[model samples]
Structure formats: structure tokens, C-alpha cells
Target: MRLRSLLFAPGDRPERFEKALASGADAVILDLEDSVAPLNKPKARENVHEFVLHHAGETALLIRINPLTSPEFEDDLAALSGLHPFAIVLPKAEGAASVLKLAGSLASAIPILPIATETPSAIFEIGSYRDVSTSLCGLTWGAEDLPAAMGATTARRTDGRYTPPYELARSLTLFAAHAAAVPAIDTVYPDFRDLNGLRAYVGRARRDGFSGQMAIHPSQVEVINHAFTPDASEIAWAEKVAAAFAARPDAGVIQLDGRMLDLPHLKLAIRILDVAGR
Candidate 1:
């Protein structure tokens, strides 16, 4: 549940599942969607089912199912019904209605981590998930498919940045997740070989209020985890804020270490402690 870094492993490559588990990622996603070839869909689903049944209790596992409209959806659901992985990643999710429909169809009560703002329509409907927060654990965005869906040249800029439109989508998804009281997870960095780029990306995400990030490769996990975790300075500040607030519970504001602390500052201190505990 404390997802600092969630790595993806292709469902067809069942042999890599254990390797991914041992890679020190907080979670591992068995991808049945984009990572699997079209011809291997059936095999991928079967392998995921077998993997789930065999390793359900060993690690935090999530299955990234194909889009809802895909022909493989029903079988995907059927294969996962009894296995009960930690959660399901609903790709290309457009709104709360889709999440509700899927929740209603499932025999088990698994929490969903929906890529809520992937397509253009999805960006418009991101707010709708607030009404169905009970069925969700988190919300994330995807940059890869949305631009292609809209016939855009690219989601990332020439300088390896997200264009303004995609940036808006990412920020909106972050706000929507917080509004729903669920964790906001940033999308993958795509450039698996660029460790420096990945570190900078993860740092930006943590600073921008994302609780965690999705990782495309195992090598990216440590950097993401380090970025998201509270550093020593942060822990010291949080402790000071907590002490100040606790010592002056009835005061509206208190000055601490040459700075004024208020309710907002106290709340952030508590959050830091909570995350640190995790």
C-alpha cells in the first residue's frame, strides 16, 4: 500500500515475476496490457492467473488489465476473480462510471488504481471519480497512449518535458486523486536508461504532490523510492512542527525557529510522520 515505486513485469514473462519481486520495488505490476503482444493475450492472461495463485501472499501484486472495451476484458476479470491480487490497474479509464461498472462485475472486492486521465475524454471526466472514491485506492495518468489517441506528435517535449497540455492533464489527475482522498501516482518516466532523468522526474513528482511514481524498469525503483521518502531535513522540520503544535494546542499560531507555524503547517507535519511510518 505504501507505493514509493511500482515496477512493471510483462505477464507473458512469468519467469521474471520472482525477479521483479526480489528487485526491492514496493509493488510489482503484472502487465497484461501494453507489455504483452496481441497474439499472446490468452497466454499472458493464463500466466498471470497462475502467477497470482502461486504468489498472492508473497508480494504486493497488481494486474494491469487491458482497456475496458478490449475483447480480453471479460477473460481478464474471470482469471483474476479468485486469485485476489492486491489491486487491479484499470488502463484508459475515462470516468467513475467505468470504475463502477467494473466494480459491480467483479466477484471479489479488490481496490482499483485507475489511470483516470489518459485520453482527452478521460481528462474531462477526472473529477467524476470523487463520487466513487470508495472503490479506488489511487489514480494515475498515462502520457504514452493519450497523445497517440489525439494524433498529437508527442506527449514529451524536445527537451524531454511534458508539453503544456499533458502537464495540465497530469496536474488535474493529481488534484483529482487528492480530492478523492486517494493517493496520486505519477506516470512512468519512459526513458529507462536515463537514471539522472528519472531521478529528476521523480523529484519533480514528489515536489508536485504525487505520493509515488510508476516505474518501467527495476533499475528505476531505488531512485524513485529515495526521492519520495522524507529526507533528514524534512524529518527534523516535521518533528519541530509537531513539537511546536503539541506545546501550543490552543494557540492559533506559534513562532518556531524564527518562523510562524499554523494549522496548515501542523497538518503537513502529521502527514510527514504518517508517511515516514509507512
Candidate 2:
């Protein structure tokens, strides 16, 4: 449940699955969707199914299946019928309706982790996701597919920051996940070689309240995990806040580090501790 970094590996390559699983990611997602070409989808699904059936992982194991709109959707579901993954990642998910419809094809109650923003119309459908919160493992979004769907050249500006529209979409995804009471997982950073950039990117994500981030490469695992994990200062502050609340259970507000601390602040401190797995 502590999803600091969810790493993705193409399902077609069974050889790389073990490597990815051992990459120290909080979770490993075997991707059967965009990563697999149309001609390779069947083999990829087989590889994923076989791998899931035979292997045991310390971290969560997930499969990213093609969208409901894809002709391969049902086939993808069929491969997972007898096997249980930690969760299934549904790409190009618009809203609860589409996800719920896809649920009929699945054989188990395995949690769903959907990429909620893909199409132009999907932007308006986030509100409906709140209804399916209990069924969700987390809510994530991707920048690549959405822009492609809109016929845009890129989701980012020349400076490597998200453009206004993509930024809004990212914020909406974050808000929707929190409003739905699920973890807000940020999308992957394309520049895997740029560890400094990955650190800054994931640091910003944590600052903005995203619970976790996705990684497309193994080298990113350490940086993503470190970025999301609570450091010494954060843990120490949370400890003090918790102690303050414990000392004055009936107090409506308290002072900490020369600042006013309220119930909300106490709650956040507790969350930091919880997230840190203390």
C-alpha cells in the first residue's frame, strides 16, 4: 500500500520482468498496453500471465492492460482470469462508468489503478471517479496519451515544465484522487538518465501532495523512493506534532515551532508518519 515508486516494464519482455521486480520499486507494473505493439500484444499478455502465475514478489505486482476501447481488452482480461495480480492498471480510463464496465470482464476483485486522464472528454469525467474509490488501488494520469489524443505537439513547454492545459489536468487528477480518498500517483518522467531532474520532479510531486510517482526505468527507482520517503527533519517534526496532540488531547489548537497548530496540522503530521511507515 505504500506506493512511493511504481516501476513499469514492457510485458513482452519476460527476461526483463525479474530485473524490474528486483529494482527496489514499491510496485512493479508489467505493461501490456502502449508498450506492446499490436502484433506483439498476445505474446506480451502471455508473458505477463505466466510471470505472474509463477513468481513471488516482495513488492506489489501489477499489469497495465489495454483500454476498453482496444479490441485486445477482453483478450487481456482473459489472460488474468485464473491469476491474481496486486492490482490491474487500466490505461485510457475516462471515468467510473468505463472502469465499472471493464470490471465485468475481470474474474476477481483485484483493485484497479486507472490512468484517468487520456481524452479531451475525460477531463470532465474525473468527478465520477469518486463513486468508485473503494475499488481503486490508486488514481494516476499520463501526459503522453492525453496530448496525443488532443493532437497537441507536446504536453510540456520548451522549458520542460508542463504546459498550462497539462498542468491543469495533472492538478485535476491529484484533486480527484484525494477527493475520492485514494492515493494521487503522478506520471512518469521521460528523462530516465537525468537523476537530478527526476529528484526535482518527484520532490515537486511530493510537495504538491501526490502520494507517489511512476518510474519507467530502474535507475529512477532509488531517486523516486528517496524523494517520496520522509527525511529525518520531516519525521522529527511529525513526532513532535504527535506528542503535542497526545499531551493536549482536548486542546483545540496548539503552538509548534512558533506557529499555530490545529487539528488539520495534527492530521497531516500523522499522515507523514503513516506514509513513512513508522
Candidate 3:
């Protein structure tokens, strides 16, 4: 799927689910984890299950289950078994082994999107997913939980950027996703009201090779989508490059618009076309 923006909706709030669907996000994440309180976990799961049963084939749906170690994990899995979301977002994932363990438990073939570096162990094991790429759809990281897990006073800098350690974690997650041959999804922007900041952050993520971003609110979806989609100029350039390469397949390197284009540049041009088509 062309996942430029994946928006979140609290699973317990079924009233908001339809609104989230209409928010223009490429995917919707029904959150049954941190968004729901301990007492409300069961109800949240039910709401999500019902919603999925009714709308499973309509839109790309994802469920964010609580961490496997939490009391709610098994119930979450049991409740969601037959509904079959597009993918499950496993929080606090420490490595590929964790993903494999979950995949082994599932009765169906559901791809996984792991929050790969939300803990110290997760950061250390980022490279482990390279071997488990078949079952993984993407790799994402969360800053809010990791810093708390690490006992850090702050996850963000005074200038609103991620702290240095968190920045490293984000970079590692991006690299791990690429190594695993899956999309790299940036974490939520947090400040739903800061559209300018969200745009800048999404632009930076796209520039850094991230395929998409998570949105905490519906308002952020459009910004993320626009930031990731190939613009008119980009599409034009990709088309020209592709045509030039096709015309001279025998030449390993060809001159395009006075610039020497090599195999790697041609490959990138093709990728841009693929993404634009998506």
C-alpha cells in the first residue's frame, strides 16, 4: 500500500473511527495500547474488533496492541484473532525475535509493523530484523516511551528537535527498516496544532529516506501525505530519466540533460516513478 500517512484513532471511541477513515490518511491505526486505560482495554478491543469486522475490506486497518509483556496482550490477540487487521503494530518491540514469536502465535498470515527501537534492548537489536523481513511490513520508533524507559529527563530538545540519543534511535530505526527491505515510518509529531512543524518534520523524514509518518490527529494526515507524495516536478524528472534509460539500455552510463546518469541514478528514477504511481 502507499502509506504516506497512517492516522491513529482510539479503539474505545468508535464514534471517531468513521471520522478517521474520512481523514484522507492512507491507513488508520486503531489504538488499543497506550491510548486506552487498563480498565478499558477489553472494551477498546471489542470496539476495534467490531469495527474491523464491519470495515475490514473497506480501508487499510492496523491495530496497535499493548506490549506482549502487558497483562492485556494475550486478550488483545485472542480478541483480534479472526478480525484480521491489515497489520498489527507491536509496541516496545526489542528485536526480530519478538516479531517472530508473535508471528508464530498468529493463526493467519498478517504482516507486522514493529516499533523497533522504543527500548534500550530494542536499540541494540535493530539489526536483528534483517533476517525476518518476510513477515515485516515496516519499522517505526517512538520517542515518548523510550526516553521514559531509559530514565531520561527529556526526549526532545529545547528547540523541539529530538534529543541526541533519541535522534540516534530514529536514525537506527530508519537504517534497520531499509536493511530489512521494508518502509521506515517516522513516529508521531505529538503537537497536533503545529502544522508548520509537522510539515518540516515530514519533509525531513522523507529526505532521510523514511517512506511515511504516523499521525496522532486527523489534521496531520494531509501534511504527511503531501510531504511524501512525489510532486509534479519530481514525477516529470522521473519520467524523463526512465525514458532516457529505456532509449539507451546498452549504455551503462548516459548523458541526461547534460548530466551523466549512471545505473544507480537510473534505479532511483525508476523508484520515484513507482512511488508516484502508488
What are the lDDT scores of the predictions, listed in order?
Answer: 0.90, 0.90, 0.91
lDDT (Cα, 0-100) at 19 in candidate 1: 87
Tens-place lDDT per residue, model 1, 243-270, is: 8878877987999888877899888888
Query: How many clashing residue pairs are found in candidate 3?
Result: 0
lDDT of 2 by residue, 1-278 (tens): 79989999999888999899889998999999888899999999889989898873456899999888888988988889788888999888889987798776777788899898888888999888999988899999999988998899999988789999999999999999999999999999999999988888999999999989999999999999998899999999999999998999999899988999999999999999998878
Query: Least accurate stretch of 10 residues (summed lDDT) in model 3?
Result: 269-278
lDDT of 2 at 135: 87
lDDT of 2 at 232: 95
Backbone clashes for every candidate come to 0, 0, 0
Overall local distance difference test of candidate 2: 0.90
Cα deviation in Å at residue 243, candidate 1? 0.7
Kindly provide the TM-score of model 1 when superposed on the true structure, using C-alpha atoms: 0.98
